[model samples]
Target chain A: MSSRLSLRGFLALSALRTVNSLSRGTGRGSGTVAGGRVGLAIYPKLLNDLSKNRQVILVSGTNGKTTTTALCVAGWGDKVCSNATGANMPAGHVAALSGSSSPHVVLETDEAWLPVALEATNPRVVVLLNLSRDQLDRATEVRSIAERWRSALSKTAHDLVVVANANDPLVVYASESAKNIRWCNIETPWTSDAVSCPKCTQSIVRTSGSWSCVCGFTKPGCVASVSGSEVRIDNETVQTSLSIPGQFNVGNAAMAATALDVLNVDPSKSLTSMKSVTAIAGRFAVRTWQGRKIHMLLAKNPAGFDALLQSLSPGTDDVWIAINARIADGKDPSWLYDVSFEQLRGRKVWCLGERRLDLSTRLDYANVTYEVVNDLNSLPKTSDTTELLANYTAFSDWMQRTTA
Target chain B: MKIALIYPELLGTYGDYGNALALSQRSTRRGIDVDVMNVSITDELPDADLYLLGGGEDGPQRLAADLLKKSSLKQRVANGAHVFAVCAGLQILGTSFCVEGNDAYEGLSLVDVETTRGSVRSVGELLSQVGENKMVGFENHGGVTTLSPGIEPLGTVLHGRGNNGHFDGFVTETIWATYAHGPVLAMNPWLCDEVIAKVTGNNLTPLKTAADQLYAERVTSLSSR
Candidate 1:
């Protein structure tokens, strides 16, 4: 073993304690990066040490990671510890494991961090959710992320069971290296990123719901599948009464159940536990402002936006759409065109956020009439329910404002 | 007016297909009959006045370049059809470009330029001067292009890297290419007008909408800071 691996002792553990105390002394909040940064600086393999005896469940994807991680933790009630704050990096993983002594752990891992997180955690069940073009400026490309996942899965296939979405070709290509994978057919409407087969470079031919490539990379048999709201597993349908809105959440719940099933957790009980989670990290959360209870839904990328756009009832009150190209969101707001903003036609759309003009331009092209809203105070004070869809930074800004 | 949205499935990364929507609507607003043909990867390129190719990932980009090299996009452009492309679209219209670490693929060769991978990915709000008209759009590309002699650039870079640090894109009477992809035409209505007017052979009245105001606002905001 390497000298670093051999150096495990009270010194490493005490180092974390000292750093945590020192960080607390600095008067920073318990939630920031200081503690985790210090712990990893000393331990190096901090997550590996913390996750030694735990049954770790690492959920990573372009979308649905936070929600799925939340669902899995909710499934176990106080049994599973997780980074529920949407912090999906190494620091977040270290912090989550250090905070709770629960034998079970769930981590919401970023898509790019999957290989590193997988190596560190030695997870029991690794959930590979759908992949799509999200934050392309920073994430680079979805195919590159998939290739990384594939390479990592090839090495660690024997140690873990991968629960992946079969509906997404990119997800399938990434998880094909796994020795054991519970494939789930959770439908995602965005198919722009997966036209070219990830493996053979041949075009993916999707007839009905099934898909296949000429090089024989076809859709695998799904262990569990969600058709609209109904989830089917082992030829039996599970009536999932989710408090969360959108069919995507139903898919998330089904995916969580499938992942939990690997741990011998009752899928039905897991779904029941998931029913209590009305919102995930303020996603789909209703925040009252100016007498309007704005049902805020996060729709940052094209895939996320496509799912949210499906919920827009035709000819409803003015739908509020906000976009920001902050670093957290991709610096390039080009993906706005990939979304069907044309669906917002015949409805008065109120544009908000920093990229409000860019979005207005996009709407103008889609032939969707819109009004640029620079401030929340300018919102109409009608008591009618108003739905607001926003990208990552814009949504986070909204959360910050309301919470503050 | 027919607008061919070329290979959106293969080359539509960064919302590249939005260019077609922008072009079509901008023409329709001016009382022109517009038919936008959503051409997928497997579909044939329809006869159109203007064709748009957007940015794409490496594999799809290479595939799109290969497909277009063999397809009628070259012959169509030769026959007075206009082509507007971005990033990967810009690269694919050139003589050759590199992808997947130095593996060079032959391009459509419609434009006299070549692109090679660079260390720094040029990604930000790019401001440029396109013949007195200031163009504001987001540029996210890694390819540094070298233009052939006498090849005209779309604009001189005022802020971000276009073809390189100094200039933005290649421009001809029949072809317009750039790395700027807030769907180029949507961000710069004047460029769209130039393409539309060139094809229609008629002067267009300056139809101002929220898009134009947004363009003016973007140019002001992107320029001031």
Candidate 2:
């Protein structure tokens, strides 16, 4: 271990391990970050060895990376160790690497820290989730960050195998120098955004739920496509066909399948592992509260919010939009104006949080009916059956309240 | 009365589509039919009176540039279709966008000058002075945009970013592009009406509705954070 690793490190490590063990004490091994004593010193060497042997995969994006990383790790099984705790930054990544004893790691990385992480812990396989504008306060422009990744990968990668969203031409375009590239796509109808032809500047058109460019070029279909027919997601993990809803989830699945395949995992084995895939807590998870099932979907950005809205059953369900002013929540709530609140239709919307008034104003402007609540102290008593859409912090509080 | 919404994917960061939704609903109240045609990499770009592209991550900009290069979308832009490009859209529409030390990505010359993707990204509520009018919106972009000659600048820098001064959006006769993300159009109907008029060339008046009045009251009562 480096100078950073001392008795202090050991104590912290032991504490986390104890917590992990306690969390799993109830049985069912609720899946925590693996490896308890690798230490931060050995991480650089691990990265070096992995790079030399061509055995690392870095997946990063604004949303979906956590679930995608978990799926890839599950697909790799014991072969891959990862930062599964959704710790995506540099220090967190260090903790993840120290906690992993595997030869290869299929890690989920954040955009801002990917460059630094790659330099320190060079990964052979870099899986880039589609980039979306997020947390401009801490994150560089998406393109600038993408260019950094492109440059770093081109320099550090040996036999790079890149898996990208063909629908998101940005990812396709960014992995320009990958020695090998395999494409995955979220079947159309599940996607609201597609790239314009990079060559012609014309908006690429979609036909029958598949994407096609007008210049006589069609992106090769996904090796493993996640279509509505193929996917089976329900209220219960055992009851539902798949784990998560929304087409973006399908894309994440496709990305995971492609990355694991690059690692030489059998398609069928990977598919079977996906059977265990459950929605990450804040991403899209369901909790039964007093006999009523409540589904929580994190709506951080417009695309995420839009996807979450699209995946939800639009009806008379009580909804909540919790707005926070954290740098991560986005400084400005103006983008709420572009969101299609029409999806809510007759659904009740409760705009709550610090930005509640801002959201309420936009809702009013769109003529979308919503009630504003600044604090939960005065929350009206409702039936257990009420469905709620909430902001991230508000949702967290609401989840704690209801779950407890 | 069918309206087409173009390049939504590229410009969808910070809820750019919400602007389109606002436009669609506003038009719907006016009894106009709307079809939001999403032009992706698979199909040819459709011709629409109005075209909107919002801010997004870098990959979208490069891909959008490449796709726009292949399609005759630039020719259409030169032919004078009303275009509303914001943030990343505005950056990608330039002659080229520089990713700091990285190679510059070529852009459609719909607007002159270029953009330098900065290490430090700017994010905050932006208020710019347009003549005597104040344009308020959220500003978030990691690149600096310089306006070339012949392009009409939108407004003077008031708060967040000034044109070419870390926070000004480039403006042309029929095209309005900016880094300001907010219900930019929602707050400023003047710009929305201007785009609508340019696209349709018909001076249609915006009518007052219950939603509109309610929105006005809410705006009047909004407490800034």
Candidate 3:
């Protein structure tokens, strides 16, 4: 494949490697977007070129794309190559694809970029985890993304199977047009994003583990269900002994196992293989810092925040909450209000970040008491475990500080 | 005081429901009792002193505008109920608003204003001079609102583009509307208190908390940047 490339294609693939190696060698960029940028600049259709003749599987949603992709990659073992780093864009896709000539490739696509990925990759299977409002500055309207997904799903090949979340009405609406589908009822708790039906302009009524709209947009009967810690697919229920902290990961595992089943992988082997991935990038990573055990969770949006908060509540622990409004994190921090901050009222909280004031104002309105801090050194030495919950760049900054 | 949080399922995008929390907490801080009714789409609109609406997507915004037009909201506003709305909430309160490139929808007509598609969608930090105090919040919307001859704007734009890039919002004795959504009330406690005062028919006492300090810091930092 490399020997028969045109002059531009050869240069683009070569440039991808040279730039990635140089960027990683220098401390300027993390080999995430730089190399891909240069490669795509030389060859506009670089992604399509790299994806040809490979069995592609796309994992995309508002949250857990990284974890779900990692689980799928781990399930396939050495046979699959993926963007293990948190780079989920076109450049990153091209760069990741340049690493190996493996016939199987799993890509964690961004929510808005899913339709683009669908058109580019023509994936054998599309995994729709869930959709909620995340980066409002970039993808402001949740329903518009659903509309695009509806169109993209309708246009895909009839043989293309979709592993979707039946718990999320938005995901159901997006995956409705797929001919081959397997829905998973993982009991997702966040319903703030989709209370209205997308097919018809009517209110959606949600019950336990299911929902229905008056105009007949109903939650389809799923093949997989997460009961307690076990994922039941068909009649076989396997206990998902996942090492991750939150129930959301249980949902991700269920979806990954179901998607792997579509790829003809054994359910037991796929779910077991997924258990090896305890932390995705820096998410759910814990380290000892400043004489206190610090647990770090990358919650970048309201959906993530709600999931993380829901998992770690009904207890008392001082949490260091950090927020940043950098371009990667979406410049608009207005979504902070979408989060349920009132849950943190009983816990002692510390706030610091680029946008701590905005976060502090949100906490103030929730009537939660918190102290503003300057740095990690100011953190009082305590016996109780202190957690670091940060969004995007704040997580990166804290992860860097702790690692350094 | 009865405060109605209207159609949260339809209009609670961008944390617009935080306004109800601000109003309730401020009222409680002043030793004033208040009832916050979270009105759903199917529930009948309850009679209340103040009605609060938040931002939403275009589809929900259109649905909410149609629903409110048929509801008792216009009658309540005529009977002197204080109303505070943000973004889509504000858009649905006007006479008419443009959406989806050329489609227009009829607003609730509570405010003598109209909205049209702007050259660019206004996003990011918004700062406006509200008489002596500068109000700061975040704005993300596509429509630019224009006032009628006899109407008044909420404030003049100071930093970000609000309304039509010169003015920030629409205001009258009974209605307060804006495109800013720092949950606006949480970012500007004075505006939250003022709405409560107008609805309760009692002057609010000087009550300070963590919000004022943070508000001052945002205004300072955003101004310098």
Task: State which candidate has the highest DockQ.
Answer: 3
Please, what are the lDDT tens digits per residue for candidate 2 over residues B1-225? 334454566656566765676567666666666666776555688877677777765666677677777887778777876677777777777888864355788988777868876656666766676665556667777777777767767776656654456447777776788776645666555556566666766767666533343344433433242
DockQ of each: 0.73, 0.32, 0.78
How would you encode candidate 3's per-residue C-alpha lDDT over A70-174 as one tens digit per residue?
A: 989988777686887867888878877777678888999988788888887778888999888888877658888888999889988887889999988889999
Q: Is candidate 2 or candidate 3 better by DockQ?
A: 3
TM-score of each: 0.95, 0.68, 0.96
TM-score leader: 3
Name the docking class for model 2: acceptable
Error of 2 at B210 (Å): 10
lDDT of 1 by residue, A1-404 (tens): 02223355235555655666666443332333456767677778877877887899999888888888888998877767788777789887877776667789899998888999999989999998899998877776888888999999999856599999999999999999888888998877888889889986668999888999889989999889997778886666778888888888899889898988888888878888898887888887888765568888898788888888886666657888889888888888888888888777888889999889888888877778788887667778878778889888889888876641
Mind giving the per-residue lDDT tens digits that candidate 2 earns over A204-258? 6666645566676456544445555253211111111456676676667667766
Give the docking tier of candidate 3: medium
Query: What DockQ number belongs to candidate 2?
Result: 0.32
lDDT of 1: 0.83
What TM-scores does chain A show, candidate by candidate in order?
0.94, 0.77, 0.93
> Which candidate, 1 or 2, would have the higher DockQ against the true structure?
1
Docking level of model 1: medium
Cα error, residue A209 of model 3, in Å, equals: 2.3
Itemize residue pairs with steric clashes in candidate 1.
Answer: none
Question: Which should have the higher lDDT, number 1 or number 2?
Answer: 1
In model 3 chain B, which range of ten residues has the least summed lDDT?
B178-187
